[model samples]
Target: MTLSALDQLKNLTTVVADSSDLEAIRQFRPLDATTNPSLITAAAAQPENKALIEAAFEQARAENYENGELIERAIDILTVKFGVEILKLIEGRVSTEVDASLSYDTAATVAKAKELLHLYQSYGIAKERVLIKIASTWEGIQAARLLEIEGIHCNLTLLFGLHQAQACADAKVTLISPFVGRILDWYKKAENVSSYPIDKDPGVQSVKQIYNYYKQQGIHTQVMGASFRSIDQVLGLAGCDLLTIAPALLEQLEQDQREVTAALSVTAAQQASVIERPVQDEQSFKAEVEHDLMAAQLLQSGIDGFIKAREQLHALLRQSFGLDEEIKA
Candidate 1:
């Protein structure tokens, strides 16, 4: 039997596990790993991961002299704890996100990112071992740009459009995670499409466009395709710079024997070079993205989902803490 399609893809792109579960990460053995607050919050709620979360919280409570301080300390401790565990699993960097609440505030985004970096450092992990994940807002991009100069590599997340990719490349950031699956999800719900065409899939097209643009313009920033819906979407982006796939999809690819070809080629990207366009500024970026209906709608929708997930996590935390309060009383 020949190697599976997923096996072959590892040759063309760096495979990242888009998960927070330590054991799942261990299972996939992705080259890198990424996690957002929503994934982390979900992981923390799991019975198996509860011990891990509690250990961080207990560490926070021990260090804090007051309840207010305890809560703040707990968040930091938990974030670092997850990063540390993830670092042990993957050979490459682990992406730890900044607070989604500060996505629009450049200064606050920078501050929170630095704080996350410091927390990871306290665990004996070097700054290079971590990728600070931030929302791809204009403000967040600026924060990442500043951090990159200071040697903090960032993973620009929630990236739905080319405008975000161009801005990040211009900033000389480390990497951009363009969401192929999430992009498909939005279109699926809106258009009632059951499946996507390989060459024409919205998610695949988005990443291919961004990848070619970066290569053509000599942008050094790496593009990682993320949020995939199916194996076809993954195989469609076989030659992407990287792809962060969920464990389930990885397993599906491993089990299925299918033809995999280089859908994206350097030759194709070089062909796009002849018509290279300059990266956009703020006003033009907003305008250009607004012109693309999919990018505009999906970007707005993704931000909404992030905000909602954050709220749900907060409510869950409050309930957990309230239970703890009763236990303490």
Candidate 2:
């Protein structure tokens, strides 16, 4: 059989599974994996993972954790637990996000990230093997900057525009995960257009622009195009430093035997010149997000959605703990 598209893409770009499903990841064998509060909650709801969820809640109870805070810690433990399971099937690192509620609080984000990393270390996983995922907000980028200084790598996520990517690269982040599908989603909805050519897709264009800019500036940070909605978006960015694809889309690539080709590269990027780099200071970051209502709305909604997902996971753990409690509002 001809090499599957997934296998061919691996030749030019590192394919990271954007899921918390161990079985799916085991089958694909992606070099690394990424998880968010939403993905983890989805995994916890699975019947096969019921025991796993209960076991984690029991451990939290034994530790004398009570009330909502108990579930909070359990959420952290569950995130690491999933990471540990993923690490078992892959040799590369895993990216676990910090609480979305802390997206604007640098200190809180830093502390929560440290707690998560400590949780992973307690499980015999090296800090080097984990990327503390954070929002691309200025505060989050600041937290990532400090984290990097301490040898803890980070993946700046939910990035939409060139300014966000510029900020992440300036922060010396390990990787930036720009949302390709999300960008395309915004344009398609905003313009009332149902379909766009792959080459003309906003999401693909955004990643390619960032990739070219990064290479032009000699920035060493890696670009991982993420949140893809279709195969064209994936194939469009074939030579990105990495692509964190969902398992369903990955399975599609596995089933299709199309020959994948590299479309972005450092050598090709050398011929590309960016118009002007965006200023990404605190004031500029806030201003940029405010000016681009699309970016502002999406970032806010993504944060709110992730926060809700974490709370839902907490409620699930509480149910398994023989208690039904509400959020401490």
Candidate 3:
């Protein structure tokens, strides 16, 4: 019997579901799952998850959290609630993001991460089962460095350039999610092109560069290509350490019975010539990000998008809790 593309690809990479929808995750049965503010907001609005949102609200109410504080607490609990549910379905880790509003504050990001872990612990989930997803800003990477010291793993997200990847590896982060489709989007608009061939794709090339660099330097930081716009983009980085794909593309791969090939390997990386850079400090990291137009713009915009999604979730929670009218009055 011929294997589906998804099954064939799994042999070379760990497949992760990039969603918070319980049914979708159940169907895909990905080895791991990841959730961001946007996914959580969408999931929280579903009728099937009404109970989870209510539970989070009740828990916050019982703790005497009120008004703005209540909404904030509920959002955190709801995020963890989704993670708990996802953990029940997957054997590997679930990435729950830190509040994107705290992306630039290292201390605040660290504190929020610990608070999130504490919430997960209350539900009997181990720290090992969760990867605190943080933006790949210099401060965010520094926050991850602090968390890793305490045995708390992190997934540095919104990554676009090799500088960010290198800084993350230097921090010894457990994983980094380089946004594949987003990079392709930026290039498409700037270069005024509809799309490039899969092999010549800017997004594909970016991940290949980062993956090869890590392998050549013997870096242990795992690269999980994320935000894929299509199955071809997903397949373009075959043999990546991991790939957190959205359900739609996962479904596409599941239905196709195409042959899959490993496009990346450590053996090839060892033979490729790679340049090493000096470790980046706060000043240099900031300078490099500002210098790279794509990375700088995308990083800020990614944080802004996540922050907007979180705010939307807060608005939904307020209306659900009958505080929307009160806030207006």
Off by over 4 Å in 2: 327-329
Question: lDDT values of the candidates?
Answer: 0.82, 0.90, 0.94
C-alpha root-mean-square deviation, candidate 2: 1.3
Model 2 steric clash pairs: none
Return the lDDT, model 1, position 254.
Answer: 88
lDDT sort, best first = 3, 2, 1
Clash counts for the predictions, in order: 1, 0, 0
The better-scoring model by TM-score among 1 and 3 is 3
Better of 1 and 2 by TM-score: 2
Candidate 1 vs candidate 3: the lDDT winner is: 3
Which runs in model 1 stand beyond 4 Å of their true positions? 65-69, 273-275, 323-329
lDDT of 3 by residue, 1-329 (tens): 99999999999999999999999999999999999999999999999999999999999889998888889999999999999999999899999999999999999999999999999999999999999999999999999999999999999999998999999999999999999999999999999999999999999989999999999999999999999999999999999999999999999999999999998899887788875788788899899999999999999999999999998999999898778545420
Estimate the TM-score for candidate 1.
0.92
Which structure among the candidates has the greatest TM-score? 3
Estimate the TM-score of every prediction.
Answer: 0.92, 0.97, 0.98
Worst 10 residues of 1 by lDDT: 320-329
